[model samples]
Target: MTITTTRPEPASADLGTDPQEPAGRRVLTGDRPTGPLHLGHYFGTLRNRVRLQRQGAELFVVVADYQVITDRDIADRLAEHSENLVIDYLATGLDPESATIFAHSAVPALNQLLLPFLSLVSVAELGRNPTVKDEIAHSRQSSVSGLMFTYPVHQAADILFCKADLVPVGQDQLPHLEVARTVARRFNERYGAGIFPRPRALLSEAPLLPGTDGGKMSKSRGNAIALAADEDETARLVRGARTDAERRISYDPAGRPGVAGLLQLAALCQDRTPGQLAEEIGNGGAAALKRTVTEAVNEHLRPIRARRAELAADRAHIRQVLRTGAERANAVADATLAEVRAAMGAVGSA
Candidate 1:
């Protein structure tokens, strides 16, 4: 995938005007909470989530706490990371009043749908999912856990539980969304009831953000600059970022990806395009390029970091926001589960 760093303006009216009501499609998207968010997440999904919410989409942002165990075994810091993820969401402009931000483990009814959902897709079909294949290939484990194997089905349940008709995902995630649509179709055909909506993938136009080393940005890679990083830290990382020996700066993603990535990052922090930024910084050398990138990144994230600090100070408030969101999610999930039970010829609690 190509690396792009252009931020789009939100085209909707003011948010929270009608907090209880949404004027657009239902959106479902989330993160694993493995670690703090970075610029990649900021440009990729976080910003888009806020934009969609502002556009009157009834957004459901799941933290996917349970999905953390699909690959790693570090549960000691899970709670801290999950709370931090919520803080990042808020800092990025996701209004809790308009967007439902909840964790997967907190929504029991949503997970319960997995039983029937699992039966709809065969093991062979599950094995064929490209997303799952990529995950397994990247995983450190020699053997796949059962949860890891059925991850795509679990994602299907996550989407169908809320009856989310639209899922914001990158191109790589389309196969996983397809599983949800398949499960919805098969369940409706087999049980003779449309209990779930076949969620559609709203593909993001923003390209991937490469790490400082010119690779896919990831927390585990240690190349990513966390959204919470201080200005000095951001500068240090950018200073050490890989760049070619050539002094002339140009946006040649194919030939000078490292320099180009920095240009893209700087452009994303403001309104200029990568090519325009490169032209403006002609012959400034890598030092000037890194300096420009550091300044832009820090300036862009300053207010967000300030908001994050305030939110982090009030730990109690953060937890309460999550609790309220979970309560709302449970109500929706329970209603869906009841409909699922009725369609499956099972009894719901009287």
Candidate 2:
């Protein structure tokens, strides 16, 4: 597969939560902003978040800027990149009113809880985290910064600070969620209190969206289909995707990752199963299959692009949304941190 892509203008229309009553469980989730969000983001968790919003669940989306800097000694573009990430998010339909959105840097209270929570968790356990190992290897930085090593601790702070009852994450992150639960459990066990409810993983239903090169669809791989990518760019990436030499189409991820990725993307956008899509491919070769999937993706993302541009135009409005979200998030987080302090006997006693 070979793809030719165009740079797309950011969109701003609200495909986000509309006027609806709240639903069953409260959910919390967010992304790190090393770059703009891609299709993997959409198919992975954003889709689930939007659906939950319509169902009337109180959802919190964190920008997670602080987490991104864990490996870097210092960053020159942190502020700029963080703003762009927020723009991509709002452009993609994160309504400030419906879902709370805040950056990790803006909330000092949440970070305060980390010291105490870390005390409750054993270092031996943190060392065993697979994510830590994977991330360190990816960074290829001789050794990880303390911040990087305990990135999961900050994650716990993010969740526990909000008193999150439910956290939506991918399967790869169950361990971090487990860590958050452990911190909550140990604190409650030792403090004679249950200040933080153990949050459960909501989990993603969509299959992991693959990158253009047939690897994991991450920004670092350059294999992603960025949500902000223009139609031509979308088409191009679809074209360049690695497919099987078989010349005919089949939906076997193990056998044809490139073809299977296209199928997966199409299946997600079309709301059909990969098997359902495979039957439609008929005798078409990989090129034909890629075209069909490309069209489906381009059509689906058109509106999101338009909306992202509209949102991008009003940078101030986007900032205001984060400000409001921070204020709202801080209100809850401050209260939680206070309780956490009291639990650790940091607060006044008789």
Candidate 3:
């Protein structure tokens, strides 16, 4: 009903340089359109992306709208959700002008690109992909759809079409990243060389930042702290975070996940380490620790949330950004598509 065609390719940020890293490298990275970004994204990659942009690197922040269909449960908020994500991104330091910001649903050509790309990859390779295995296991969907099963292909198409050289990914996502690299290599091997640049993975500074509940901070698990959440919401969520019965404050993630989770949040917010904060706490009680961490998180996210609200007001502006981004993204993708077709002999040959 919502024009469920193949998702458009996402926008990427990276310099248009040769694979030899001439000048600088181009980057393609983004979050799923399933929900708003969270602290995990912020500290894990968003912060790094902002730093890269400032350093005169070309970058693309894809909204990954096509990924939403792999788990198309959020039918009501498909378009609206993607638009909100754009707003959150703008409020953060992801300047649209500096980077292309396209959604999956908007660029149908990327999906068309997937046909040939998927052929280059083998079924065994897809089966061996750890991320796909994890998603299947986590979703518990006995009969997985082809879309869910072949997500790596979509990822390959996403990065390949954009010719992204750098894709910052978490360690857990290495398997998928590997798939993308493998596909890039395979394409070059099948056709001539230089079909697409093999994207490098930028592993997170602190991979898998634990949620307030001491579990992987994910939306499905209800443990994530949304980036656009207000000060009151952030405080309430922090207050509800899991902690240990021991009153004394100490930072031991393995031994005391709940309490350590608080410390991690505090440290990340204050730009300190959990152990350092633990030493500073000396012999503070758990209540004091939670209160302190909550306050710190509140302080850190207050400005971000406020800025998000201001940006959310003009949804039209966000749409314009995405629209403008698609034009720029397609300009690059179309040329690449033509090259790919010519290389594969698909252009003039019926």
By TM-score, who's the top model here? 1
Better of 1 and 3 by TM-score: 1
Top-down lDDT ranking: 1, 2, 3
- In model 3, the runs with Cα more than 4 Å from the true position are 1-23, 72-74, 140-142, 348-350
Model 1 spans > 4 angstroms off:
1-22
Candidate 1 TM-score, C-alpha based: 0.93
**Could you give candidate 1's per-residue lDDT for residues 68-146 as a string of tens digits?**
9887655548889999999999999999987899999999999999999888888888877788999999876668899
Higher-TM-score candidate among 1 and 2?
Answer: 1
lDDT of 3 by residue, 1-350 (tens): 01112222222323223233422667888878777778887777777777677666688777887677675544457788788778777776888887889977677777778888788777776876778888878663457778888998898888878888777776677677777777777778778868787777765566568888899887778898898787778778887888877766777878998888778878998989898888877677776787788788888877877888888888888889999988888887778778878888885433
Best-matching candidate per lDDT: 1
Tens digits of per-residue lDDT, candidate 2, 170-262, equal 667777887887877788988999898887776556677888888989887889988888999888888888887786677899988888888
RMSD in order of candidates:
5.6, 8.6, 6.3
Model 2 Cα RMSD, 1 decimal: 8.6
How far residue 100's Cα lies from its native spot in candidate 1, in Å, is 1.0
